[model samples]
Target: MIQKLLDSGLHWEKKEFGRYGFLKTSGSTDTDIYFVEKGSVRIFMMDENEERIIRFGYSGNIIVSLDSFLSGKPSELYIQAIKKTIVRTATKKDFYEFIRSSEENLKFWNSILEDLVLQQMEREKDLLISSPKERFDRVLKRSPKLFQEVPNKYIANYLRMSPETLSRLKKS
Candidate 1:
């Protein structure tokens, strides 16, 4: 399914996320974030005052901001690669046109939307009820392997705790 979509004239380009990639604040469209067939990426969240590292995304994972991109508004987050990475991207204009022109594309997008919604709901629920440490543990359990790939400070921020607190929790 996805293979066909990729084969379509999806204008995707690959670039390395360097040490100086800025968190773009004025994105007005959704984009397909794909790691090259060989690399990985780190997603980050940044505001005017501070920056927070969020998640490590590997090859085959899709990065789409449905709400902000679809609405032609600024996205709430920024993305960067933690290592040498390559990504294929398609903008919001391309997304809608593809759906309107092809059934397969539409179906693929629908499935992606469902996955995003379910993940969003789950994250929201976790935020509502879980303590900081509990949330941290949950993330670790879900992706036990990622801890080795991402830095400790990034993980600490994602769990809404300081690096010191994460260190203390790690000991206990």
Candidate 2:
């Protein structure tokens, strides 16, 4: 999968993660980077000194920080691979060049963004209208393989529930 992504013209190298590793912020250099492949990256956003599990990405997924990468601005979010992983990246310069040179690349990114927006909207709707059980079920429905790949604690955090509560819910 990664080889196919690399063959498509993105530039990146593989990276590994410790038990608890972090991708530090680049206060100055904002690059248009993406994860061409990732085994299990735990993505998060920090607010009020609290860490919130946002999303866990699998292989063949782009991992660019939208605002930061596009605008060359700093990002508040932090992303780390919970498990060892491989990632591919493209810089902002490379991205723009690719867009101008290849309409196919532009379409690819546009489609990815569209899918992301739709998924986010669905998550928002679930937050508003779904019960905890329903939300959990929905998560499973959307990403059935995630339960096998990600730890339950992280899943609980992503679901906005305590671990104990998640355990009880899972049992029931």
Candidate 3:
């Protein structure tokens, strides 16, 4: 999508986020999506004081508040920088226009949506798995790069386990 936009003669500014900086805060209606040029970010919501991570975007990934983008409403999720990051942004309008501008781009967007659906289904299945070890193993088998790119503590939260449990699982 980033490349497609660039190929379309669209120019964008690259923004920097220091570690722990917020790109979008909860309750803001920001319809912008960012391509992670470097580093990583996480999309999460607070659940009674607990931060539940919904997703992570690593280098070369696109990050956005989907609800806000789709509904044009205040977002309940936070897009936070996990490390110092650089991102190029596109608004929802530009994104839609770019994707609809070409048949190939439309197919590309469709493919991305399909992958997101599949990933969400897998995440639901993972949450339903009762055993921490099983959840850990399933995720590891599916996205081993997650373990490499994301911190164990955040991964543990995503897996609904303690960081200690994740460490033990890695050791085993």
Best by TM-score: 3
Q: What is the C-alpha RMSD of each candidate to the true structure, in Å?
A: 3.2, 2.5, 1.5
Question: CA lDDT of 50 in candidate 1?
Answer: 80
Off by over 4 Å in 1: 1-4, 26-48, 52-56, 168-172
lDDT of 1 at 106: 87
TM-score of each: 0.75, 0.85, 0.93
| Candidate 1: residue 86 Cα off by (Å) | 1.0
**Per-residue alpha-carbon lDDT of candidate 2 for residues 1-172, written as tens digits (9 for 90 to 100):** 3344467665555565554565435254457576736577776776677678777776766766666776777877677777767666667786677666667767776877798788788778767754678888888899888888788999988888788877888788
Clash count, candidate 2: 1
Tens digits of lDDT, candidate 3, 110-167: 8877887888899999999999999999999998878878899899999999999999
- Global lDDT scores for all candidate models: 0.65, 0.71, 0.87
lDDT for model 3, please. Answer: 0.87
Tens-digit lDDT string for candidate 1 (1-172)? 6666678887767556655353243353434545344355555566677876545566666765555665656676666666665566776677678887877778888898898777667556656755777877777787776677667777787677888988888888
Task: Give the Cα error of residue 35 in candidate 3, in Å.
Answer: 1.0
Candidate 2 local lDDT, residue 29? 42
